[model samples]
Target: MSDQPVNLVSVNTAPERAKKVIGTVIENVKDKYTIVHAGNSATIDGVKPLLLSIQPPPGILFCASMWTPEEQAEIQQIARETIPGIRTHAIPTGLQVQVGPDGVIKYLMERIDDIMKV
Candidate 1:
């Protein structure tokens, strides 16, 4: 409340409310410090899209991103064993993926038969 201006930005530490939000980030994000919060609605709005993006999907193709590690053998194993005519390519890290080429195309194409059988 002083008339003299003071830099209060660093004065505050992340509180218990912010602490609670860390649990909600995904397994990947939990390894880093990326939580965002404000004391109000604008803060919540800023973070909504990120939370939505991390939500797990219902099937194989759902795991696609621009790229994930080449070492997610479990997902690949499930795709190969359970789905037909599906193959995976392991592109190197940080190379751009092709447009009009769905990264998870193999998985998506295989989903039709599984979905129909279900």
Candidate 2:
């Protein structure tokens, strides 16, 4: 398996919750995979910070956001253009579990693990 990191992007509004989720995913994977909390960015330009800050490997992007459909599409387009070849899994705001139930975290971890094994 590759040691490449899985980037998880979400809205900047919930920093603490994002941190917790990032930590949980890292711990759950036992650090076998690098889980990067790519931090919050909901715009096409906002993605610049993530691209500049992290040289993320070719892995999944777990995007959880509360943006409008238009905004989501723009972000997705920007990500595809900027990152080129990486898989993205968008988790709508309604399904995101920042805290409490570990369903989201579990799902993400599983997806990442499966990808890594490939």
Best by lDDT: 2
Put down candidate 1 lDDT per residue, 1-118, tens digits, no spaces. Answer: 1232111000012333222322232122323322232221112222223222332311212222233564334444444454433343333222224422233233333342342232
Global lDDT of each candidate: 0.28, 0.59
lDDT of 1 at 87: 40
Residue 17, model 2: lDDT of 65
TM-score (C-alpha) between model 2 and the true structure: 0.66
Q: Listing every candidate in turn, what is its Cα RMSD in Å to the true structure after a full C-alpha superposition? A: 19.8, 3.5
TM-score against native, each model: 0.22, 0.66
Backbone clashes per model, in order?
A: 0, 0
lDDT of 2 by residue, 18-79 (tens): 67776787778764766666665544566656655665532445456555566666666666
